[model samples]
Target: MEPSSSPPAITEPAAAGSGEPLAHRRLVFGIVAIALLMASIDQTIVATALNAIRGDLKAELTWSGWTITVYALGQIIVMPLAGRLGDQFGRKKIFLGAAALFTVASLCCSLADNIYLLVVFRAFQAIGGGAFMPTATGIVAEQFGRDRDRAIGMFTSIFPIGGIIGPIIGGIIVTYWSWREIFVVNIPIGLLLIVLGLRFIPSSVPKATSRIDGTGAFLLAVTMLFGMYGISSLGSAGAEPTDPLFIVAMLIALVLGFLFVRHANRYATPFIPISLLRGRGFGAMNTINFLFGAAMLGFGALVPLYAESRYGIPPLQAGTLLTARAVGMICVAGLAVFALRRTGYRAPMIGGFVLVAGGMTLMSLAPHGLTPYAWLAMAAGITGIGMGLSIPASNNASLQLAPDQISAIAGLRGMFRQSGGIVAVSVTTAILNHATDAGTTQAHSFVVFAAILLLMIPITFLVPDHRGTW
Candidate 1:
């Protein structure tokens, strides 16, 4: 195929008053980072708190799993919509509104008396948090137009940093206070972001005139929600994969999913542009991202439960143990950037998946017999390193392949990764529910995760070994 023409240069929103002073740019970057950090940390903070929530709410394990599933679903649903909304409205308007919504939702979560209420509120919180991410990315890209590469580097680092610290913070809070504090803590931060954002964040004019693809969005949301619900139901006690309801939901999801693809292809402005997916390297990178997200976040979600169940570790200790993975990710992320510079994208991409697969294999062995805590932590760390290595490389590769559609590509990447998270949490929970033995069930689940990661390794080879810098 002939090389596609370079996309027209992205112009900054005229209303935002580009070419701001250096100090002003730094202030905006800080605001964006703060917003991004809060959203990122929220993703993992609840992983360690699931047990506490279940006990407090008198909820079944399967239902409690919805707390994570619903939040991710909300994110997956809102990411693309949020980007388009931001483009249609204004970044500052959407960011502040989302921040405010998040603050209110956090308060509601803290006050929720039942698991059902908590899940509903958590979804709202996710809407706000999810919308903040892409909009913040846009803000940074616009504010630091020429120097966006450096700005983006700083912006992206917040995710790993937030992930690294989230469990520790959640543990300390849950230990001293209650899990409610986890949501409560966001209130103050969210409010501060709103206040700061109002003062520092510039408003951008609508850059695009495309209509929101409401039908496509609704169809896609139904597809994911039903698909996940069906998968999770398979693991419920007394439930069988062949159950009529489960089969029906899956069928519905499949049908809607097919319709969504057809709709996207025909729509003038799709939530996920079909052309981007058709690009040479873009689809492969996203596939790797999807699998990587499933393995990485799925394992992270289950580890605390594994530790608590096997070792009778307290929530605080379990949370601390979870940090080993983050340590690996944070430590390796910088090194991965350098490694990418030396070996190009292919080595890091393939090597990262290999490490993750290896780590999952080690983790799967834990259920059969006694394994040292240090050994488990080492495995977690290795998985984290793999995540640190591969994620950036894949992201860089996607940009290299579709630099013209960077915004759309980034949105799709987030959507696919969160979609993986939804599947991982649901499937792992289902496996645990159906198994008679916790150890064996978890072991089996890790093995499945390992297999998924292993499959991603070869797919990474399909990505062009692009040596160019972003």
Candidate 2:
């Protein structure tokens, strides 16, 4: 594959105001942040409302889990496509279209009377939500060229902000209203984003002239769908790792994945540019990002259930506990931006993983009897702080390393993170399903999460601490 003579350059739009660049940048940030928050919050908010959805829809417990699975599937499948599309079309156009789709989908989700219908609507929602993150990141990269680290840090921080708040907000809404309210809430947020985004978001010229690799895209989608679905299935009750369906899905994923890679290497412009992965810095950052995703998202799924079962707390109370984790992330992110300027990336990256490992270990060792709520909150807070530090550091490193491929790399990074979340959910669910006792299951899962995080500490050493030239 030959490189195009003219690759897309990330450029800033003309200022609309009285030469106030800061104000213009802030407007751009606000537009992207709102889109990012809407997308990120939807990822976890549904977890708290799953039971309510199941009961109201009269859906089987086993099948109802597809609500989350399908939404994730949409995200995994569309992220790369969204990035490529934004590059081929205009980022502003793609962002607005996606945001509109997400808003309409949310309305449809609230009206769905059956679980299957709700799941379908959720996928549409995911399509819009997934596109928002990478595209928004791309905008930040262009708008804050020299200060991309600080801007990226602020943008990346919204992910945990939404993650921390989703369940709490979901719980409150569910407690006061109906489960459908969860979807209903997104309607206003999404609509407002669409209106504001069209007015304020800057337009960019399409960068790519190459035709998309349809075959490569299809093959890659097949690999992710089968692989993720198979892994998630393993978490079901009485599920066997050796189940025929699981084995078949895994086999198919492997074969299709190989085909996709081969096709990508040959195609002029593949769905995902495989060359990006060859870079040591980009590759290493993605690997650590994957681990972070698994630990953070996986533990997030387990905590509410763990809290509810261990303490006999109501769903609302259990969800509220997640606020501690959010608070930790917010606080660390602010400090990390300053710390990175003074210390560079290596210290925070290593220290962040250490904190994550320690927190998970603490959670695993919680007393078998009724664990104190304060103890749970503290452990979660520690883990959140670690996540807040590491994720942005890694993301900033990736952006700095591959400034030319901002949207594409951002999408790729998202794919890795979401994939980790999928795997984590699957692995933990399987452990929980197989264990006879709840406490033991939770401990085993935490240990597994901690072990994965510990691997990141060594890997972080491999990441080049390229402090941006201020």
Candidate 3:
């Protein structure tokens, strides 16, 4: 990671006195937004088609879940390394490389004749996809150092905005074409990003000298996998947490994982520098983010399931409901810069969570046989506001706290956020599995989302209200 005293300069020139700085900045944001959109869309492209994937692949429900799990796992495994790679090599090289890999993998995914091949390609796609989120963020930090808060507001909006629209777009592709078309859709977008990225993304060199921590990286990966497995297991009582055999295995993994983190802090050049964790503001923000991540991730997946399974809605309709969330995100995202200017981040942060909690509560009351369109639209939009505010605030806080090491701070935030998603999905899946009879899974899912939303309130206060360069 580069030192705070001197970070990478934005290589792309402003559309010189185009008499519109906002428009020029928006162009850059547009490019980053599109890259993020590609990645976000892929997460759920296979979502509406989960059943089709299961039927075509002849896999059981458990294995079908891996289509999503493997991709997230791949992302978790690669996320930390991306920051280091971006810093050491250059953001443009890593960004373009990841984009290219993601593009090719998408093509492979479309053509896979079997589930095994599809899963493999998905993992490959994730490795590539993982590079994108962090790199795009690092670019924002690099380019918008002067306007840190607004930069984060814009940067954070990209994914949720993408996520909001992805399901709708994905549904269209699946409905009009086939499930495989979801993967195929990325080809043109990916190609364009690669071209745009090369022209715009600046090259950078790391200011700090440190060796890659292969040992620590390996251990962190193991720890996350084990932790995720434990989380996945907790999703069901039938999947006993203390089965002697599973407990023993988990213990071993936990022990090694702990040792790995410790070792990394002391010996290895860890993917996340332990030194950064010492920043009280940054650390607290990240902890809060992890909780937020868990809730948001669970809801992200479970919402679609509810619309499809409970309402007997088709894939496209289900997707439209999900797209509403993104629309809310995009709308709130535009407001974020202005909001930050007025509120200094703290008030909006609290308000965002409040909206989320309130929205989730409203969703819990949705009556059966009622058209979910109205409820879903409100819930999705409100949740987007909560998400839009929280993400930008938390991201800016963490990055500012560690201005010298944007890569490392951004990497850690990404890890916590991604891991939160992984755990949330695992737990939600487990809860949905347990709560639902054949008849009421959809309702049960909402109840779970309500519970998660209720849990986010206290955590929101941990964030500080003041604005600084950090």
Candidate 4:
């Protein structure tokens, strides 16, 4: 690491008249928020239509699950590379490129006639979508010269906004129109982001010496692919963890994963710096973000399907189950923005985890005498509140420690979170594919995962938790 004597990347607050106009800064946040919204919406919007998509495209349940998994898979694979590229080529360049790719790919997704084509398009869409967080965050870090904490804390609220809109819009489209409409929805939003981004997003200095680590990236990708295959095997009829395919795939992934880490440790310029993986608070933060992903991306996507299978809820209402969660998040997210400094990171995060666990446990019990929809919605909302309480704290906690490498830190956080989502979706599908009663099995899975989430609480102590900047 650079010696403490080195000048910091960002110095003291800008003078009253030194920075860009306040309105322009607001416009910039608006642009990045909208970009994030479009991508976040895509994440939840498709969940409501999983069954519909499967039926329309004539895909097997296992294959249909790929619609979600592949997107996350694409994201995890591209994120580290995206971070480096942003550093080397300027954040605005990468941001605009990502927005354009996401827009074009969404159009392709809407036009796909087969499941294979749709999945391919979704993966391509993810290539762009995956870059959004790292690049937008770098842009935000530069623009928010002062009150950085408040600005970033507020940024956490944007996802819940997308979370709220995605499922509701998804429900409506899946209920009355074709599922294809979901992807079509992104076209205009993406275009607007691109146009505004081109005109308004300020450019950051590129690091001429930044280098990409192709070897490490390939190993990581291969490892995940093998691991995904192993997980998918468990969903097969009469399959077990010890099945030859599962064992072989997972063992290979394990070996490769080890190698990837070893490579990162030794390489002069690694794909993701080893310190980010194992450095002080960084390692713990990555772990927390990974688990958080299961709560945010995994839980939201599966609820609609769970509600449908378990209670025979219509697509419209089932989709709102996610909305309920987002609503609860909205309730707490605003508070987090203003109150984060007072509560610090650890308290809110641990509390959030407990709430998430409690909410999941609540969802599992549709008691003998209650309305399932109300009960589940309440449960989801509780989970949302838990997430809202923690998100800003977690988002800012890691960045504060490494302000200069904003994009890299943000990308690493995103990679772990998406990795968690991938694992969650994979496990859920694997179980559903083999289960006799999918709904019952899935509900029980929620309780089991909730228990695991609760078990993860002690690890939060390892995370950084100061009231102000690190």
Q: For residues 284-313, what per-residue lDDT tens digits would candidate 4 score against the true structure?
A: 888878887765567766888899998999
Give residue 242's error in model 2 in angstroms. Answer: 1.0
Score candidate 1 by lDDT.
Answer: 0.75
Tens-digit lDDT track of model 3 for 1-470: 21223322444233111212232344455677787778877776677678888887788776677788788878876777787677665667888899999999999998988888888999999989887877776666556546645765676666765666666676677678888888887899999998877665555555445766677767777877676666666654466556664586578778987797688668855655676654457656777768767777667666766766666666566666656777777777767765675666666666777777766666656555657767776777788777776666666666656565666567667778778877776656665565645226555555565566556556555556655444
Residue 198's lDDT within candidate 4 is: 72
Worst 10 residues of 2 by lDDT: 14-23
Relative to the unseen true structure, what is the C-alpha lDDT of residue 128 in candidate 4, on a scale of 0 to 100?
A: 96
Q: Which candidate number would show the highest lDDT if scored against the true structure?
A: 4
Stretches of candidate 3 exceeding 4 Å from the true structure: 1-28, 233-238, 243-249, 307-319, 366-372, 436-464, 468-470
Candidate scoring better on TM-score of 1 and 3: 1
Quick one: best TM-score, which candidate? 2
Displacement of the residue 48 alpha carbon in candidate 1, Å: 5.0
Residue 364 local lDDT, model 4: 85
- lDDT score of model 2? 0.78
Q: Write the per-residue lDDT of candidate 2 for residues 385-411, one digit (tens) a residue.
A: 987787667767776676656777788
Worst 10 residues of 1 by lDDT: 1-10
Error of 2 at 145 (Å): 1.9
Per-candidate RMSD, Å: 6.2, 5.6, 5.4, 5.7
Put down candidate 1 lDDT per residue, 1-470, tens digits, no spaces. Answer: 11143322234544124433233567788887888899888987887688899999999887787787778778887876776677666677888999999999999999999999999999999999888777876777666655454455444457878877877788788889999999999999998998888776766666666777788778877887788778766656777778898999999999998999999999888766776665557778778778877887778878878877766777666666567887787777776665565677888778888898888788767444445576678788888888777766776676556543445556667877877866787667766766677766887788888888878877877788865444
